[model samples]
Target chain A: MLILLWLKNKLAFIPYFRFMQVLLSHSKLKELISSLAKQLVEKHGSLNEVALVGIQQGGVAIADELVVAIRKQDPEAKFEYGQLDITFYRDDIRKNILTPDRMNLPFAVEDKTVILIDDVLFTGRTIKAALDVLLDYGRPGKVELCVLVDRKEHRQFPIQADFVGQAFETDRKDKIKLVNDEKGNKQVVLITG
Target chain B: MQLSTRHLLGIKDLTQEDISLILSTAEQFKEVLQRPVKKVPSLRDVTIVNLFYENSTRTRFSFELAEKRLSADTINFAASTSSAAKGETLLDTVRNILSMKVDMVVMRHSASGAPHFLSQHVPAAIINAGDGINEHPTQALLDAFSIKESTGGLEGKKIAIIGDIMHSRVAQSNVYLLNKMGAKVTVCGPPTLIPKYAAEAWGVEVNYNLKETLEWCDVANVLRIQLERQNQPLFSSLREYRISYGINRQLLDSLQKEIVIMHPGPINRGVELDSDVADSKQAIILQQVENGVAVRMAVLYLLSGRN
Candidate 1:
């Protein structure tokens, strides 16, 4: 696993799995989450002006893990947490009917540094929709992106994640998903034909 | 999830899953209404036409506002102003509108099955706002949404729909929707105002006594006595109806348990529901109107996704 982590971006040409391969196991996922939390606290000093918003469905799980990690580091952390569902703001709404998930942003987003967290960054369309949704709420002081795993070089929109747990150069058709394992643990997996 | 039917012609046409989908989507739209900017761009590319052959205040405004909230381009057509008043047929009016690329039609007519008639002739989606005494699907959806919001879920809940049951498209639609959602419904009014077939056909309890119905139910959806629709007097007078069926404060206080109150707009003040009960904390009459936009938006959004 350590060797696989060291050979991060070099796995672009590796024969992709037919079934699935666990990219980030339990312990490795914990390490990446802690690192992401540390980076957030280091960048945004007191965590007072920052608001962590998770994209609904997958991103919410990663956001929960990050919140726990951040709280563990600083027990007095007073950052705001929110969950957003961007199904209504999507550009492909005319294609098919999509069911919306929960969206609860009790706190104000005006003039706050909003950090959007997602499980995997792929075509960047979800981020675009998230940005549209956030702007409707209020003007933010600053907007940044964070993802547990970044699938590089496949962005359809001009969006990038500021804090990334892992970056992989993979095929356009390849799928990277953050899912829960049997023991109720967060794991990132790569799926291919 | 998508609606099973292409047109929201009536609640009888919807499956349990379809009702659940619309209510859940309405819940999301309700949240959108609470935000500072209460609009979404889901239906920005769609064009809708509201065709009203009959006069309406709440339904028309609610649908127009719902369309605006979804960012859909809307053109309002009243039978009094347009070619409809010049003796133009419903089919021709709709066809002429569709020729200009209208994607959907929200219609209300004095004739029952008028929207259904247009659905067979037109290419666009049809949403029946109200059709004579047939059904008002959006009103029922909003009532269901309000009931769910107030009392939680609809399953196994007792709901009494009181007042002019025979002439109410709202009452018919409510019966269909609430029944599908597992709510035990009792239609209460004077026997003259309730259809004889309501019990056997709709599978709802018919009670002429308002007090007994109120005591048995968890929610009282008091409907207005539609004087405009009534050709002849169903009862002796408004004062007599108020004495027997009116839901005053004393009648509500007599019940052992508190019941959620709901009305589908334009209350008669002292006819079906009294002023004190209408203004009380138990009444969700205002919420019903507020939920109307959200529920209609959900319907339009779901139907526009269909081919």
Candidate 2:
């Protein structure tokens, strides 16, 4: 299995397979997440007034990892955590059927510093929708975004993430996938036909 | 599921996915209804005209509240006060309203397919609030939404729509929407009230026995009898119909399993359903009304996208 993965990675370096390159290994992702948590703690001084909201599906796992890393740095930190599902807030709702994820925001978001977390930043439309949905909850004192991978192409909205793990440029046909193993191991891969 | 059609004329024009999309969108609007602000800026720039030609209290109020909650400017046009009462045709009245640069029209007319006719001629989006005995799309959408909220989903659920099936646009719309959502619909009423072609046309089970039908269902959606619409008595008497099919607390207590009860009001308390049963814990009648605003909000939001 190790030899097969190594061969796949080596083949991904070829120009033809460049679209299917694995950007970050599981350990590298963990290191970046830890660094992000440390940066957040230092920037905010404390997480008492901070609220970490995960955009559904892709952002959920990354949000959970960041929570654990933040806790490790400050065990007594009391950061509010919630999940936001922006399915209904999307502009393309009339064009297609979107199965909504569970929206479970248990606490109030009023007057809190909200940190929106997602897996990848692509066209920035999802972030726009998330911002619309979050306002319905309450007005936040400030809003910041954290993303795992930033695709520097085809952005239709004028929005950017405050903290990004890695940045890459890809063509329109290239697809970015964040894969997670059964043991919670994470990897980012770019796929193209 | 995207709503490909420009106007929501009936449930028959919608796909299963379209129904699902509407329900999910309504769920989000439901959340907004629970917020302290209870308003959104999604439709701030849009203008809606509630051109209700028929008399309505609940549906009109619900749609008006939904439009206001979405921050859309709305104009209420009743036929009693407008040119519709001056012998103006629906086309002319709607065209005049459209000329005012209306973004959408929520219409309730006395003639069937009135909205459909206006939809073809007018450029604005048309939402059928209720058109005679044809369809009330929003009512059915809210009924389906309430059922989904209670049971988590609509797939494989058994729903029995009782009373005034022939004169009810609600029954027709519910039958189509529920069946599309994979629910088994058994429409029950008196022999004279249940039209023969309903079963043959809609392919739904038609049963005259209410007790047996209720026993085999998960939800009982009781519709109000349109006494004003009936030119002649369809049944022998109101008392006779009530004795035969009226759902009371005694009948409900005898059921082996508890089932959710529903009624589209203004309910004839002693006629279709007893006040006790209507006020019972299993009844989701109030939820249906509350969901109406959210469902209408979703429909307006989606339709405004086309403009």
Candidate 3:
């Protein structure tokens, strides 16, 4: 009977495991991020005029990668970096209890072309909240959005990212997992029905 | 990690995570206070009522300043001139204030659990400033915030809360919060002033020896002896209490390593702490007072969230 139960569980997991596919591998992620950094520099004219503000948690890792890529291309390039925690500024704060991470902005955002970075762009609500919080710090010369995975159909707000690594269509119940391990292995996986 | 309750009635009602959240949020608000344009539009549309049944100068002003900094519309209600003096009940008075569409109530009452009682009856969010000898949570939060700033963190730090432990709401609040944040808390005072059950109840060490406690602690939070609250002499006399528990310059110099001195003021000059010690570089009483505004702002902002 125990063998039968184990076989039943294995049968159920097969289809779920089949649907899980890696969208980005470690090398591809590095190459794509480096290209994105080069593109940002090209658009902004120089890295000095550009400032990268990463949303807390996942976005910070993506921002770190972008900074490394930018420096790889131009070793003398200097870019303003910041990390913002938008937990307090969320519209659904009453429904959810969120403990915000530390918001560290060492440099001024004023009169700079601030490129807001995030890992996933789902409903665009997090970006909206980030925009609200960013204004409290200072007014920027221009604001742009960058995301690793843009769920194009899931946007609730009239928001769009200027630069995107990849875009995918998924069901409402589907989950996108950005797995960046401690060993510097990066992979994007889609778990869906 | 989020504060589950709408009302911050006491530190006893909060978890370790909840206290940490308040302190972290306060850290952000402290940065806002340093800016040229200090006001934030976080609570712009929210209205708060500062209802003080008991007389308070520091707590009341701090809450008011915090509310103003958040750009919230504030109304100050004192019991002396209010309808409470004209034989109005507490429930009726708050109901009247709520009828004007007040979103929150920051209250300080003489009776313990007074805010807790009103929290059940009213729909508005309640913040306990002080309710008798029960708790002064924001004061505890600000104290902890100041200590965290000075020491980098509260974990593994020794804090000795000195003076009238039995009657001090600040002492009770501090003991609960400091312990939760991984700080070793020792309640030091005269035996009469330090209740026997304090050690058993709160799991804090009770010490009568002031010099030993001072040497043991990294920070000594000296509480003012409440002469107004006490009905009879708990200690031998004021002079005896000062000699036994007082944090003076001589006592300050005796310590091998410099420790931070803290007082939740209106401090008695020579009672629990000496004047020189209160004004010294080691003292963070003023920093505690300044952090009070930021901590209250954080509390008000967190609680003001609604659907």
- After superposing candidate 2 on the true structure, give the runs of residues whose Cα lies further than 4 Å from its correct spot: A1-27, A42-46, A56-61, A71-77, A85-102, A119-135, A139-145, A149-193
Off by over 4 Å in 1: A1-18
Error of 3 at A38 (Å): 1.2
Model 1 chain B lDDT-worst window of ten: B84-93
Positional deviation of A104 in candidate 1, in angstroms?
0.9
TM-score of chain B of each: 0.98, 0.98, 0.98
Question: How well does candidate 3 reproduce the true complex, by DockQ?
Answer: 0.27
- The local distance difference test score of each candidate is 0.91, 0.88, 0.88
Best by TM-score: 1
lDDT of 1 by residue, B9-123 (tens): 9999999999999999999998999998999999999999999989889999999999999999999999999997788888888899999999999999999999888899888
As a TM-score, model 1 comes out at 0.94
Cα lDDT of candidate 3 equals 0.88
Q: Residue B88: error of model 2 in Å? A: 1.7
Residue pairs in candidate 2 whose N, alpha carbon or C atoms collide under 3 angstroms: A96-B1, A97-B1
Looking at model 2, give its docking quality level.
Answer: incorrect
Question: What value does the lDDT take at residue B10 in candidate 1?
Answer: 94
Q: DockQ for the candidate 1 complex?
A: 0.64
DockQ score for candidate 2: 0.22
lDDT of 2 at B296: 95
Per-prediction DockQ: 0.64, 0.22, 0.27
- The local lDDT score (0 to 100) that residue A48 gets in candidate 3 is 82
